[model samples]
Target: MVIGIAVIVLVLLGLTFCVIPVVAHRFGEAAERAAETEAIAQGARGGVLAEHRVRFKESAAEMAIPFGIAAVLFALAACDAAGVGAARVLTWIVAAVLLVIGGFVTSGQLRAAQWTAAAFRRSSDPVVRGLDTEAIVSAAAREFPAWLRPLQVVRFLLTTVGLLVVIVALITPSAAAHFR
Candidate 1:
């Protein structure tokens, strides 16, 4: 029973660490880029300031859906009837790699945004110059921030945890159904 329960947990963790992050990254990118573009169209300064308001909100919203669903699944798995195994160690390794990449991505985002903004500012056209420095030009482009380091670490941790979850799922020596 313990093994089965663990397996279920492992699967849920897999979705959380793997699937959820991908979806969040994708949609969040869209939301941010779009919001920035909209901000520029309306006229704003302090590019950072312009993007902070609406784009931030949109990015969070875009990311929340998948993680929220994964959370629910985790809860469900926790109440399952059996124990799980420890074979999921492999998946964690993969998750760690993904997270490392994610870290680079986060840092890259900030650099890219800075360069893009600088380029826009240097353009010879006055209209482009007048377009609001703080506002984003598109939905897909924005600064990622240095905080990605922690996120990368967290991702690595989660991958390790996910492996443990799979182990639990496979070992299932006991059952906690009806209530844990």
Candidate 2:
């Protein structure tokens, strides 16, 4: 039963931190490109400022890279450690919160990608707002804050503690001589 639970959680942890972010990055890049293409085709001329839309998508993709690795390592250590119990639960909780934040922020990149794609599609469509694509996107892009910055620092600390927990869990052994 323990192994089963461990495997399932590990799989989810892998998907959440690994697959989602990577997949999202690829989509994000594509979306950014599509948005730019739409902007250009819409008779929007060239400039570095207009290209900023593409850069945001790339930044979002870059953000996902770390969280992906963190997820796998975090889960691997988590599964091997004998579940959250006793004082260790606090450690796990902190790690979990950090992981959640990391995952959410990383996923936001993917969200941004989707948003760009939809924006392009909307701008091109006759029924939609059809506002100047570059103008709107560039304006919005300037205002978007990097959502992952806070998560990056907090999760780094959390991951360090989690690693220590894994080490302690590994070395301490589950068969306590005290109980015997």
Candidate 3:
């Protein structure tokens, strides 16, 4: 039961943090490029563009819920696994921390996109003033840093390693006995 719960939670986290973003970015790349080009042509400042690419200003509530749930679940799993040994506890702790960090990173990226899109929509530039704000916002939301890809790779690898360790520990009879 513990193993089942852990696997399910990890799978959900993987989908939420890893798979969906890559798929979204791939499908939305062209549109984002077009929007950036248009925004540049309309006299959007380079500094603003750079800020839009990196800065994220938004409420924390968006990140708190999902990450909080994951944290709680992992904590429960760790407590249940405690009698097994220190290794499971350590692995769960590491995985929970990494997952929380990943969630924050994702939340920031999303907020940056929203901020950029809103900034563009409010601009007085001729092209921006005339074009559909919805389209502009959609494109801006799709924009992400080049570094995100590599970061995602590292995050996925480490999280997977931690998850596997937990799963293995859970499967062993001696380890599983404690949870029961």
Candidate 4:
């Protein structure tokens, strides 16, 4: 039972942290490109300054939520693996709360992305929106918070600990069974 729990936790952490970020990043980039392409084709040539803020907000939120959730899950998994039983429950509650906050922020950022796209579509300027769509895309994608990398480092340590616990649990089922 503990083995099962450990496997589930590890798999979820992998998906949440590893897979989701890549997928969400690609999704956000695609959205930005599509929005820009459609706007350009529709003759809505504007400047970068006009849409930069919205794109930054949307991109930052897009990136932050997955990373934040991954960090929280790593912490929770480590706690669970340590047999911090009640603390695990509290950690889960904390994760849920953090996720809810991320959701609200991400949702608002998505709206901002939509608004940026709409602005591009409705833009009356002939400025061409700074000409290089790639630059705009890259700028937004790179707009992550400075503090995110430190959190990622902490997540990495927690992940290492969690994996070690799983390895130990697998090698001696009885020893880990109590954790279940």
User: Of the candidates shown, which would achieve the greatest lDDT relative to the real structure?
Assistant: 3
Candidate 3's residue-wise lDDT over 1-180, tens digit each?
Answer: 555555555545544444334444454455455565655655654444444442222234444554564565555554554543554565467566655675455554445445555765676665544544445555554564556545555445535554555556566776556655
Candidate 3: C-alpha RMSD after superposition: 10.0
> What TM-score should be assigned to candidate 4?
0.43
Quantify all predictions' global Cα lDDT against the true fold: 0.46, 0.45, 0.51, 0.50
For every model shown, the clashing-pair count is: 39, 0, 0, 1
Stretches of candidate 2 above 4 Å error? 1-7, 24-30, 47-68, 71-91, 103-180
Q: Report lDDT (Cα) of residue 131, candidate 3.
A: 45
Give lDDT tens digits, candidate 2, residues 42-111: 6554432243333444356475665665564555545344543432444345446545665565444435
Residue lDDT tens for model 4, 34-129:
545544554545434345443432344566766766666666566666766564445545544544554454344434444554544454555543
Give the runs in model 3 whose Cα sits over 4 Å from its true position: 37-42, 45-87, 114-135, 140-180
List clashing residue pairs in candidate 2.
Answer: none
Poorly placed runs, candidate 1 (over 4 Å): 1-61, 64-87, 109-180
Report how far residue 174 has shifted in candidate 1, in Å: 22
Tell me which of candidates 2 and 3 scores higher on lDDT: 3
Q: What overall lDDT, based on C-alpha atoms, would model 3 receive against the true structure?
A: 0.51
Better of 2 and 4 by lDDT: 4
lDDT of 3 at 129: 42
lDDT of 2: 0.45
